[model samples]
Target: MSLPSADADWWRNAVVYQVYPRSFADSDGDGIGDLDGVRAHVDHLARLGVDAVWLSPFYPSALADGGYDIDDHRDVAPELGDLAAFDAMTAALHEHGIRVIVDIVPNHTSDRHRWFRAALAAEPGSDERDRYVFRQGRGADGSEPPTDWESDFGGPAWTRLDDGWWYLHLFAPEQPDLNWDRRDVRDDYLETLAFWADRGVDGFRVDVANLLVKDLTEPLPDRAELATRTDGNHAYEDRDAVHEVYAEWRTLFDSYDPPRMAVAEAWVPAHRRARYASPESLGQAFNFDLLTAPWDAETWRRVIEENLDLAAESGSTSTWVLSNHDVIRHPSRYGITAAAGQPNEIGYIPAFGVDPEITVDTALGATRARAATLLMLALPGSAYLYQGEELGLFEVVEIDADKRQDPTFFRTGGERLGRDGCRVPLPWTSAPPSYGFSPEPAAAPPHLPQPAWFADLSLERETDDPTSSLSLYVAALALRRERAAGEGLTWVPAGPGVVHVVRPGGWHCLTNFGPEPVALPEGEVLLASGPLADGLVPADRTVWFREA
Candidate 1:
């Protein structure tokens, strides 16, 4: 079947796959994945039928925050490969009709970046220091942080230097927030966009896109004070000034041949999200409400409706995502419930399953995850698939504490288990140890440990198994490309715990979220996430059909 074309608005309903570079495949046997590794796996992506590949950061980094702390935005990391390797990989993906979207860390730069190093050496208020958000301490002895804002990871956002100066880092201490007010910082980023666009990159995935321009005008509000305010403005996050930066970027992106595209990883409020994807700003913005929603029918329907409505407001298509590098795998996340009848906030759950009040039902989670996939893929807009989720890989909850590397784990003093479990290396073959993740069988272990049960879900084992999650995804994506037509859906009134919606082309999708079978609509079954019983959609299953 022919896939979608790379037209000006190709991303409208595209299925983009995310590759976490370090865990995808290690071509050099260095226990870390590189661009060469990605090049070798192009065929796998082609066979899986993705429209584009959204690559995670592979830029020069100390891996301080798992490559998010980039020292140079223009060059590839020596460990990952050089500019030449990156070009080759990009060419390889395009050869298979897959566009490439690379991550752009415009919000911050690594502390070791040339600009940050210069800022450290230069005296306070110097031009070099102006590239970053550096300020004098506020306390009597200049000992306290300029603001009481807490880092997204943990602790204070400001890291104090020996000179009693402070710099803001919304994430780890190694990643210093850039001063977007500076003309040089903005111009340099524009040049970075041109650099990659010149190198055949199709688009960019803007990291922390909403946090670039902070409102640190004066008297920065503390966390406590901001909590009580009714206004949506903040000292750092989702400020209005950030949209100006993206407007400049939209202009630059429009200059390209096919007109490059971008998706904002903005964690702003639902009302503010569409602003990032406005016609004058970035082309798209991620909607993560579905990722954290519970596996309930009412909640799922509400989130989908809200996302579609918001996207419509901005003249943009909705973006649906189930899992990513930072969060727990959906299969594992679907396994739990709250004892107090409160909704299970999937975002806060730790990797190790350390919360005694919560318990996991593996079988139930897997079933729901498959059902959720059909629901997401059948929706009216774009979708993103995280690596290894095709094989239905569960979170590796038992990694040795010593092997843990997420700074959140350290910053929180192990109270929070962090995201290492979901970042474990992919298993390509049904083998022990490295599991074909490394080119060499005896290559050193993957940076993160893979559970032994991974053998059953390896690509080699699931490639031809029609019942496997990988096979389900392959079939779903193929069918979606051909038959997932229409702009909106009409809700078909159904019994409790059952959701039935019909799309534009007489397409009918029914999902049974309850614990019993439900009557199916009168149509030809095109696909079912799991086996149906007596022509009824089984519990925890989803099915798509159409008029015969």
Candidate 2:
């Protein structure tokens, strides 16, 4: 009912909702969400019963990669409002007993950032250029990139400027990677961390936490033919030196009275993930297995067990996430494919149903999505939820190709549709136009066009129906808080493709992942993701019960 009854360690088991500022609720009729938008909706989070809110980047930026290309770590974007608006939002969240987890993009900076501008203006090897990951091109006349590492957004990691030198940008060309080896870069972040903590932020979600330090000591190899690897031995990503970066952050953030917490977006292999969340490193490195797991029971069970085990190994609580701003919404994903297969690699990005020429069954996706929610919430550890998921929002894959803005879309030359679908503005009211995302005289057409069908799934419509997705989320969250599952998990062999788990307090959660009906273990049905039929546990359904 309040900030957690527990100590500062609340994040260990918190349900931190992720808010993508561009799409959440827009105030001032800007058609773009702002700090004030979040301020007005703090009660929505509080009523949903989440412990905290993890806000996506709202910093000043060119938005080259949708705000991941941050220009200022210490200042809020003028469009989103100034520092005063951010402070007001944080205060409002605190008033509603919700923790604020601001995103920290230490991996890269927008090309428009002052540091990058100075680097470009100064001569090669100058102090300004040294502050970033800039290097002279290896080829004669400097035509070729320094290395062959591919940018996550697309093309070569190095973007050649007018100068002979090329700067590294693991993502879009507009987002130049920072030189973590530089003392100035490291020291500069300390001030940024303190600036937000002083503003009463409870924690930070470190972006690209594992790729800070690069292995630029040697002649960078051209990875033109190299494929993506998940194993932790990358030249730049998940490097051993990156772990030290988080450790320093831990010490710096701990200086705060309540001691701010941090979660790393490190996309390392299973074996190496614990290092990032160990006692000395960032408090929790995201456990992405669940997000990438197949909808089958065996896979979900394994993901759950492995995540919990790894958290124990590191002496940190596990974190489970279904979807985020960058990925396709779970419901749409569940509908797109009958089976949820493994990811292409460690940091594989889903193309939002664009990869395959198939139509998604939205009804089926919604059913399984509700089941997936129960399975995740019943597990022991924290859960990260993206906004709009609670409203059963599906990916808007049909948005006109011309309306797409993701750098991935342009950089990949339309091969990938990018994340524009899932980032559509939230539908607050059922009407057309802004749908309550913005007020009258809407601003800039919502950044991305909202689908017409959104009116059917608006919060206003859902709240009127008890069986709506929003209603289910509220009820499930209430039960989750009331009967908190303990740190223990025991799996009962409930036949193939059925995972029945019993946590402490005699609570059991059973999910039937197959088409065949599975007999329920003797218990009282406390909650079900879907309607029960003939007292038999239906396939593709999940239910939480108390053992008789």
Candidate 3:
């Protein structure tokens, strides 16, 4: 086999595709996606010009939180495949010069996990119970949860046991939070990372990187208390102790022949997240400010400036992301906004809370979505692409309540719709019986039902049409690889709602976010998110020009 790249610095300005494994491809016709499915589909990523693929949580799990509640870190999910499948998939990806980044759930594990199960069966103060966060109830009869800290998925963060003790779960009850302060817990994850690294995996995408180190000296603090402590201290998030864990991880990452790397899903504030990305820490973190910025040139320009600056200060490359497995697709999110300049805080909000008031204009959303892709890809940093955004897929908000499985939906008593919309199996073909995600029509229906309307956005349709969203993504990614790999960006003066960016290789990207068309620059039209007419870029369009 060919040796891994000697440089080992591939993430700098690289395009990494995020594949929700269950929805990517089904090679076994088992109605669920597996590692062989990824091996079969690496060609799509190669053709799309991505440098790597990040698989989201393919480890053994009960699918309690869609595989995020990992039951086994060293083995693949039974429905997915075995360890041999993972090694084969990694080998195939490396064969095509594409790196493999597996997801690591460090904050918690499924209640069914061996450690958690053993913790439950052991005495309250036993060594096994120290692996996770367990506490006695607060009430006289030990009936109340220890804290009022709510789960990000919904409901209380603490699960009460029949034996008068309670377990802490920052997410769903099925996902019990682990106590990182315990030496065994830290050693366990370190060993898990080494296991994947030894198996030839390139890197990892750490889940909830900010929430690892909790302040166990005090009782669980409420959100009100969490907001007041600003002395560079937090109850569980952005704690100084978290960096100690990453320092250990960094040492392990650097020991590889090619020196592996990791990017943290660290969701600290925009201006102050550099510490988590120090060279001794994770070395990279997701800058989500741009993902939530208003669809205006000024707003986007500022977000881009701050993110790149922060990355530079921390000695790390900026990582840009738009959508992932946890939230609504950007095309749908942009379409529901009323106007270009409207400010929206679009995080992971539930559908049941907002569908009654919001209506999405699919055409408008797709137009802006393509323009945004061009803008993000042209920026001077690494970029992340969710699986279906290339096909211009919208959120599937019409799943029947009985079919919904996200822990958030049930935890909130149906007050929230959860993340099922984003997790629906991808449509590979325009036909029925699991689209082409399954190999045959007779296969069991996909684990989560796919919407029939997904046909229009199927890969078959997108692949056939040259002007489809897939074409734009392929063309833009190729251009980004060929032209926009500089370490800095120079902004030229343009009118309001226009961002004029000049990269290192004399390529210019002009985007018009206002209500009217703008005159194109004096250069050859290399690629445009939409068709150029009369040397003018239409409103909500982006065009890249090769300078003479």
Candidate 4:
């Protein structure tokens, strides 16, 4: 194996790609993606110029919550691959000059996990049960749930056991919340970190990083009361105690050669997000405010500036994300026109895709999505790209209800369409069967159904088309690697509905969000998201240039 690079701050301006294992590729023709599949596709990432790949949960699980309900923190899922397969995949990615960042679920574990199973069989107040949040009934006859806390997926957070006790689960009932207060729980995670680091894993993407250390004190405060407190003392999300856990993680990360890094998946406000990414804590925290914002100049500008400023307060660079496995793809999100002449908060809304009033202009959405990618890549810090986004894939909103696997789908009784649409398997070739996703074209269907429309958006179709979304990403990423290396970002004055920023390396980026074409600034164009109209940047386009 090669030695680690000397540039320890490689994550600062890096562009990372998120790989949803089950949807990326299937090597064994089992119709499910595996580690061998990922290894086979390292060229795609290397070609796209991503510095690293942040793999979503591939640990042993029942898929109750789409692999987030991890049954074993230190091993890979059998369907995906074993530890040897994981090592081979890591080595392959490293050979292609890409770092590896795997998801670490610290907050919860699957109900089938050894610890959870042991806890279920143990007495109520035993050490086994103490490892998780187990509470008593609230009302007479012990029939009522412990508290009224709601699951993030939907319904109630507490599940009543047959023994008259209840267990807390902030998400699906199959994933029990871990009690971070327990010494064994904390120690086990520390060991988990070492296990991966020893196997050449470069970093970790901590799942639900802020929700780990909950304030599960008695006379449990209601969500309203918890929301009203700014004291950093909360029931579940973003409690101050979470930082202490990250601090411990940071020390562990620093122990590795060249020092491994971590980016937190915390859904807190801009201010608290900085703390999660503080130097003493995890090195970076995802800034997802841009993912939900409408395609408006003012809104995008405000979120960018606020994130940059707040991240600076904690001496950390901001991390920008447009879409992930959990949300609808940006192409579809941007396609929908709001009813009241106002831009809709796409991913943040409840029951996002199932609304009958929602209408998506696919063409317009793809255009805006490309423009957004350029803008995000031009920013001062790191950026994350979801898999298949380079192909400009849209959400497969027409999946049959019976085929959905997301916990949110069943938990909400299909009221919320959930994230299955976005999690559909990616298309590599335009042809039939599994669309080159699996080795056997006649193999069983993918874990989640893929739409027939994917033929047009397959990598094979766009691989050689210079104007295609995949090519745009390849060219933009190449330029970004050279031009965006510096940290400087100076905003240039532009007309209404336009964003212009100058980088330190003579690089200038401008994005036009208005309805009309705008005159290009005096410069030699390096790259453009789409074709320029008569030397003018068209609406919903982004351009990068150097002063002529």
Which predicted model would earn the best TM-score?
Answer: 4
TM-score of each: 0.97, 0.95, 0.96, 0.98
Order candidates by TM-score, high to low: 4, 1, 3, 2
Evaluate residue 394 in candidate 4 and report its C-alpha lDDT on the 0 to 100 scale: 90
Better of 3 and 4 by TM-score: 4
Mind giving the per-residue lDDT tens digits that candidate 1 earns over 37-120? 999999999999999999999999998899999999999999789999999998899889899999999999999999999999
Q: How accurate locally, in lDDT, is each candidate?
A: 0.88, 0.83, 0.85, 0.88
On residues 267-383, what C-alpha lDDT tens digit does candidate 3 reach at each position? 788655898778898888888876677688888988888888898899988988888888778887787753343344454454433555566778998899899889888888789
301, model 1: CA deviation in Å?
Answer: 1.2
Q: For candidate 1, what's the RMSD?
A: 2.1
> Candidate 2 lDDT, tens digit per residue, 310-404?
99999998998888887778887777652454332222244545556455788988998999999898888898999999999988877777887
Better of 1 and 2 by TM-score: 1
Instruction: Report the CA-based lDDT of candidate 3 relative to the real structure.
Output: 0.85
Residue 247, model 3: lDDT of 96
Candidate 4's C-alpha lDDT?
A: 0.88
In candidate 1, what residue range of length 10 has the lowest lDDT sum?
342-351
The whole-model C-alpha lDDT of candidate 1 against the native structure comes to 0.88
Each candidate's root-mean-square deviation in Å?
2.1, 2.5, 1.9, 1.4
- How does candidate 4 fare on TM-score? 0.98
